[model samples]
Target: MEKADSCRRAAVEAVADVEPPRLYEYIESVLDRASMVPAALTLESAAAMSPEDYVFEDQDGRHCAGESETDRDRTQISEYDSERIVTHAAGVQLIYEGLRLTRSLAHDEPWTVADDDADEGDLAILAADILVARGFYLLARTDAAGKAVRTVQSFGRDQTRRAELEPETASAVGPDGADSAPDSLDANLEHDVLELAVRAGAVAVDETPSPQLLAVATDLADAAGTSFPPVTECLTDLEAKVREQSLEDSTTDRATSATDP
Candidate 1:
């Protein structure tokens, strides 16, 4: 009984860690796989469309460039052009919206009942709910894959960190026990480096920047046609310092071991 309880608790905790589907991911999935529908047929097309051919005037009355001219100032319109333009492609957008709604309903559906064991009807409903959730999950996965490609293409290699700034004119002392001179160039460099680092997934706002992150930022900046030699030099110097510190630590550890009582 204790083992079973422990297993149940662990399973619940694991499920808790799985986040719900994001709106962007859900939309992307439906759009990518949705079947193409005719331009004339839309969300309302299914019911209204008939076998009889329908004649309609072009909304923009212009037959050709110079054919229709009420006046040079007055713009001619055509009746045929009156049809609502489906900018997002109606069929796919509608299906995606439906999927989003279904996913929401499935998530909110209740499984609780008076009895511990669910009845046949309740079980069937539960199964349906599970299926809906699974379908949404699959869609989210596909969307995420598409988004990853799109994001990479637009960002052109993510560099998310700002460059470190160097102090301009040095001062002897300031109120904060440091130099009072401003480092505008260093500040701008730091901003650029940070932006690149964030794009490259090297550093995050909540996380401390590391030497590797600095290196990545430098490379990204170079690719952007921006020279950041000072930052590169600083990173190199920092790496050397780290190596020296590590060597000193190892030497001290060896000495301590040899002299131990």
Candidate 2:
């Protein structure tokens, strides 16, 4: 919840100065329903590798590693500048949400002109554009910028491929064929975005993420599947997963150290 709150605040602040108040208003409203987990996941992924302790409290009072009140106040703060990580997390989240909204509009086809003025759908498009642009703005100077761009590019490709799939030909095509199911195609966005979040978070602490970290990240993304789950659902088990990975890393380091001269 702390992570989600931080992400929302950062996201809102990212676009606080946009022109035409209505656009800001629209984006703000959307945030209420948007899953903040993507950004939270980013923070969590980094905190997992951070040398400093991060104590988390919820209804269950599940702490990360510390038991003292002093540690609890840490609230997942990384040794590196957290401002940068928060910004990166917000950027990735905004891009994902913007694309998600755009996809929904495209699928629903709810276009209409409202008495010579842009209607709700038009406003939504504008909002989506603003969201993505702001997201890029936030990430432009960060190391994760390239990954963010590629994620969007991959999304576009997936959507394009989905558009070309014909219902009648879908079954005729093999499981791995061009005419793959729309759900699978749509799910790629979530998977890619989740991966982006993890990479962005991990890089905040370590220069490069280790193989085990990446494998865990991939498993988390796969578990998320096609639909974007609620923040709680996506995050509840994350600490345990990260903790397990961290333990494995420690054990391997110790074994290697013991074998060294």
Candidate 3:
């Protein structure tokens, strides 16, 4: 819960600078309750990490700092770097939520829109677009930007595949459509977003996530499915999982190094 709270605060702050009052209000409302699992995971991974090895020399071949200043520089880098990573996580999560909502409206048709009274549906569409754009804005300068973009691309492709597999109407689509269950292609958004979360988190501290860590992300995504549960419920033992994966990765690295010529 604390992690979620931290994530929410950071996410809200990230979007607080939006110029439009109404759009900002809509974004804030969504962030007020959006699942923070992705962002939380970023923070958790960051917490468990140490800074990357200090650069001994600049690109110009000049020494950057001495041992006396190394710790201070690392601390400063870690502080700002974690913020950037978590912000990227928040951005990706927003994009995922927006896409999810758009998909729900398109495929599920949760509500009807009268020809003359399309305000509600229009607003929802606008909000979804805004959320995704803002999310992209947040990730634009971060290391995870490419990953975030790919996640959205994957979501779009999967949705196209979903439409082919399952038509617009549930009952009318029949047996062929019925195979596309909630946990099938529909759940891929959650799966990919969670993986991105861990990756973004690990990279913040200069760590490449082990396969085991990513597997944990998959397991967590499967548990939540497409319902988008609160991260507090979904990531309850995330810290332990991260720690375990860290130790496992360290051991693998040691074994590999020991075997090297």
Q: What's the residue-level lDDT of 61 in candidate 2? A: 33
lDDT order, best first, reads 2, 3, 1
Query: In terms of TM-score, which candidate is stronger, 2 or 3?
Result: 2
Where is model 3 more than 4 Å wrong at Cα?
Answer: 48-78, 110-112, 115-117, 168-183
Tell me, by TM-score, which candidate is best: 2
| Regions of model 2 farther than 4 Å from truth | 51-80, 112-118, 167-180
What does candidate 2's lDDT look like per residue over 48-160, in tens digits?
Answer: 66665555432233443443567756756433457777777898889988988888876665554454344778888888888988888988866788888998898889888
* Error at 38, model 2, angstroms: 1.0
lDDT of 3 by residue, 123-217 (tens): 66777887788778877766677888888898888888877766444555436555544338878888888887776777766677668888878
Tens digit of per-residue lDDT, candidate 1, span 5-64: 222222222223323444333333433333222111111121111111122222233222
Clashes of each: 42, 0, 0
Residue 17 alpha-carbon offset, candidate 3, angstroms: 3.8
Top candidate when judged by lDDT against the true structure: 2
Per-prediction TM-score: 0.18, 0.82, 0.77
lDDT of each: 0.29, 0.75, 0.68
Looking at candidate 3, the ten consecutive residues that score lowest on lDDT are 56-65
Q: What global local distance difference test value does model 3 have?
A: 0.68
- Which scores greater on lDDT, model 2 or model 3? 2
